[model samples]
Target: MNCLQSVGHSRFSALPWPKRVDAHHRRTAVFNGFVGTGSLRVAAMKTSSNSRSSLYEDETEEQASSLDAKMTDLSDREEKSEIYSSNMTQAMGAVLTYRHELGMNYNFIRPDLIVGSCLQTPADVDKLRSVGVKTIFCLQQNPDLEYFRVDINAIQQYSKELNGIHHYRAEIRDFDAFDLRMRLPAVVSKLSKIVDINGGVTYIHCTAGLGRAPAVALTYMYWVLGYQLDDAHKLLQSKRPCFPKLDAIRSATADILVGQWKARVTFKWDGDDCSSVDISGLDIGWGQSIPLKFDEEQGAWLLERELPEGRYEYKYIVDGEWVYNSNELVTSPNMDGHVNNYIEVFNEDVNIEARQRRKKFMDGDAELTTDERKMIRQFLDSYKDDADLDEEEAEVRASATSDAIASGTIGVPDKA
Candidate 1:
């Protein structure tokens, strides 16, 4: 409920109560005291047109930093929740009728979307729109819709209304990296439409908005925000504190990163459940003549072999089915009337690739001890590029620079 004022009423009505077991049982609550003045920040929410910190008059600082946050305590949680909910009452109204602010359950990811729990009621939908949500992407199926219920017409009618919001759904299978990767194109395409056409804020959710939604959001961080994995994970955590600890997904994503779709190809096929997937390509020569067995530790059916630098058409044989890789590394028109997926090979620096991969695993500040990171962040918070400094400022600068030199980054550049 720590939001701006509510919007004027339109013909769009409240959402219907879903006919699922115990909707009340899973009531989402916000944590008030947990987000205030110190580590956590509430910046002007990100939008397509807004400048980097343009819209928000930070009740505090503008950006939430992953480097320095104290552990949130229960007493603080209770205290902050009361103060925040009191402020948000008018905006969230009865829809977000929980005791705490929304951050207990979700975060408004800057610049584009409100990544949060499934819309249980029209009230939640109203709460979202109150904060500039224009589109809703629900990834979970409403359990009530599985069979024709007695109130099917009314339910469908209500869903059609859905507060007059643009809604999309791309059913995700189980939460494996392979499944998520397969679904990425659809997810990206849908979100791209929202950005390209509607150009407003969006909300994407699953049943919990913790796992599936964030998985897709993390993918967006890599694709749209141009964030490496470390930065993306830190940024997501800094924004959505409740963001699920997806070590498996992280491991899978990291593992999957091993494969490159472009020149000097690296192809990965996550066939954990399947028997085999192979990179069958012309010009790669030998080894690929038969279906490739996926290396279990590799997390996918991986192919990294030296081939003369050039383009060549290829396809993945997954358990005997000829599947298009669709990564668009390369493609060609086949005589068989389908476009063949292809690969390109070029001399790549193995050492550089290794170093780049290593860099993705950790942020620049990762090597610093927690306390050192906090100290550096504090010093940086006061240091600004625009400001002119006097003697005291000069001393602080010199000392901080020396400390950095003593830290991990001051070492020799490694390339061999």
Candidate 2:
């Protein structure tokens, strides 16, 4: 029998104090070959004739079992619906965020980059046409007052003018917060598709050209240019000068950009491999050297190396003359106008600068130890500077050179 029928039988048996009579009633119903709804009615009649027990108990149990099965089915459907709804919401939110970050006051004048005075303006629209910007991604929710308010007709008109693509996404309430990690892939994917189809400039802007616009642009840089988070920030700052005012936005952008960069870019070495050196015991000065000992290989010398991420002041010593490498990459500016590269390592670790400072104080003179000198020299030679010495600077440099030689801080070249 079905679960409903079995539950009905159990309910009839559960009736109070009529143990003998209820058994007799059940036997009479069974002998009559009761079946279907008609049989249930017959069984009810027999039950009433014998005992005044609640006949509704059997019916109630059957109904309860049916209700439970229905509830389970409903629950499964609700779960699936909720999942679909949540996914749809997240996808819509990301699109809206991308548009808001990129759509405001977009200028097509600079086709390669989107220039925005604010988030929206007529001049920007004009510039977009001038630069042959084919796609306009509006991230602003309300070109009017409400977030949902959008200019569908105007967007359609613009699209017709260029016979290009126009997309508008709005950030609705209860929407997910902008997630760089989740959204970057979609943004990059969209950009790549746009570039592939149109092969023209794609301008991205937001209200202030500050938050989302910069973020989307940064993702492009990370994915397209293979820039690390720190490097990408520097590049964007150089281009726009104002981006990511809030610390949280800045931090989040950095994290997302780095994460994307790591996924997209891979590094390869083209030169000979050498031994590792510890320059932690060196003083900070212009001519200090850090020692490095590598396994000797015939016809193969260490061509270049990347220094640990930090600020370092170094000059190359080539053939006994203090020289600077013109080929090395640097991130920050020194006392000189030249830029120095930074190395940002994850995890809390020992400070290279602190170690160098301690070594400087303890050693008195800023001269590099035998081991320290080699490493520092190697670092400088790997990345050289080409700034020509002026007459006045040359004289001062000569004086310093003489002093260094006299103090045995720098070794003189052998005269053959």
Candidate 3:
């Protein structure tokens, strides 16, 4: 009998067993080409001795199970690596964006704690008290301009009555005009000392809480918050708007913070040739040191520190007497026809406020009628032609018109 017929199957039994065995061998050879030599060898061995065939089948089943487990392990490792990589990327991104690299978080300074002439209202004082503000630092020089005409004595009396709140005044006129070179470091030192002693919130303010306050605040943001100068300016504007009207102040502030400007001390006689008299007695507001520099050649005293953007009151010590610089330009008025020197530092908040105001007008939400619009345009055009209105005056006029419209004193035209 042929091998195939001997192995069983009716069709193969009818044929010569040898021919059927030959055909089965050919089929095995063809199948082996597709299934691989190892599988073919096992199948061939299965047909041989029964004991050897069983052993080969068991080996083949073991190899298949081993390969499946290996593939599962590789897939699991790949998934784990992908997850780890994604988490690492996110962590790196956060590290790059975080403001405080040394782990100090930015503490929010309560608005009420900040001392200012603008904050003289009863509601504002009450708010300050409620917030547990321990100290008020007034940076204003003139009591008349400052809403509350309370002197140092009055402030001390009030503090005594209030129990916890202490009041200190630094007659800093044009505080914003202090040269940032000398001013920034001195102010920062003073503020740090105050914070250490009070251990509570301290409010530092000048007239509008914009110029001097923002300058000092900006310095704090840089030293404490580790912010770059540009970023520091932006952060200050977010808290309080300070727009520098003076070009020098703007450039000086930028230079100081970015290390673009360096200050050197020099001493000489003025035009009067007064001996190097100690003007140290005069307080230009930022404690102790009289920031006077003598120019030997010009025979004039030049301020070593460039003032920050804002108005300032400064007097040169002539023959041991304090005297204002008549040549210095001023934007705000003072008592003696002497204008207070003003500087405008660039502030993003000013632009933001302007944009918001423009949007309100453009949206027609101000309820401006056609007649009112025509009148407003006429007024603006007239001022432009006359060259009569300064920026502040123009802004005041525009704001008044807008306020009137918003209050319904002006009406919009009906649409057909």
Candidate 4:
């Protein structure tokens, strides 16, 4: 069963069919059993005794011609519906393809995923890798050149094109079956991890990258791209010139992904009286701290990043001192045994930003960027700090700190 043996199951007939004519017996097999959901290569294995086996054993010349014509008509209509139909292929411009080899018509469905046909030549693989593709989603088994051409060796042949481009295969037989809906969560989750961690390009393809790949791509769009179901469908259609048939994507997958999107939260960070913000748990940069720009609207240094359901730890640096959240009774430790403040993100659809917007606290804040505000705050803080020192020393220290703050040499400090 794993090796693409024709099982003659009812599901096989539901797959994108290819016409196979038995020249000797004048019989035809339109649909066949699929290889497991490993890759897009539907290594079809046709059953020997078709239940609809016709008695064309003694077919005359006219009957054979008629059968051939019927097959041709069916194939032509199938082509018209394909994403790679000649008109659609030409309409997609250079961004898509339906060329001689494996007739792939790949186009970007999202910032993360590109859907298309199989890689026909080494150049095709090179083109993908050149643009920072880290993963390839193959839809077929070995040598479906009529649709696409690929094998482990064939894909591995161009390994140097990337930092070892990884290959993922998910054999698609029944796009709308309960099996597909059940598998959708795990598949979408893995794809989400790849896009989230790397933020790099991924090439997803079935032999044609049309029927099966688009279905999976649509799922990715809904779950990971943060798009609504209708939006995802429209975007996929605009790029590839077709969306998966209504039957290809089940309602359950749509509900799960759409629900996930609404459950996610936007984590916003605002730094006051600081030139930059650094986090110990995330990649701020290439081992460098990220500088935050003062946002006049927010009246603080702001950075907004999306966060999913998880526990994260972070600390803020203001005026060269770390501010730990007092909410945590006991901080968690990293492998190095150091402690940091933590927060748990849940599916509470609360808008922290909107509430904060109504209350603007410019009272004694020292992070103001305007020159007039800076001087006024500096004078007030100076008088407060100057009370403790001798007259001459207080005058000198006040001038030094004020000048340093004005010159951007040091971050301004607030009251003790």
What is the overall TM-score of model 4 with all chains considered together?
A: 0.36
Give one digit per residue, the lDDT tens place, for model 3 in 186-240. 4554454445445467777655454555566655544443454456565555654
Stretches > 4 Å off in candidate 2: 1-111, 115-124, 142-153, 164-178, 245-416
Q: Candidate 4: deviation at residue 169, Å?
A: 2.2
Please, what are the lDDT tens digits per residue for candidate 1 over residues 1-416? 11222233212112222321221233222223334433445544567865556545443333333212212232233344344333233221222222221231458777776777655444565677677766677666444122111233342345446433455565654223234544554555455444444446877776446556777777656544456556777777777643332432342333334333324446666658878776554443211344565686876677765543334456666776656766555444433344556553444554577446534532232233344334433432343322332343454344334434555545645899
How many residue pairs clash in model 4? 11
Best by lDDT: 1
Task: List the candidates' TM-scores in order.
Answer: 0.35, 0.31, 0.33, 0.36
Alpha carbon RMSD to native, model 4: 26.4
Q: Give Cα distance to truth, residue 353, candidate 1, Å.
A: 8.1
- Candidate 1 vs 3: which has more TM-score: 1
- Model 1, poorest ten-residue lDDT window? 9-18
Candidate with more favorable, higher TM-score: 1 or 4: 4
Model 3 poorest ten-residue lDDT run: 1-10
Give lDDT tens digits, candidate 4, residues 1-416: 00111122111111244534322333333322322221112332365765423332223334445645655554443443343333222221112333332234578776667998777566677678776776776655443434322345655556433343555554544222333444455455555544443346889886556555777788666544455556778788888764463332433332332222223433334545556654433222111234445677876665555543333445555555545545443365433344556555445554555223211221112122244334423332333212333453443345445545665877976879
TM-score of 1: 0.35
Q: Give the poorly placed runs of model 4, Cα more than 4 Å off.
A: 1-103, 141-149, 174-179, 254-416
Better of 2 and 4 by lDDT: 4
Clash number by candidate, in order: 12, 32, 18, 11
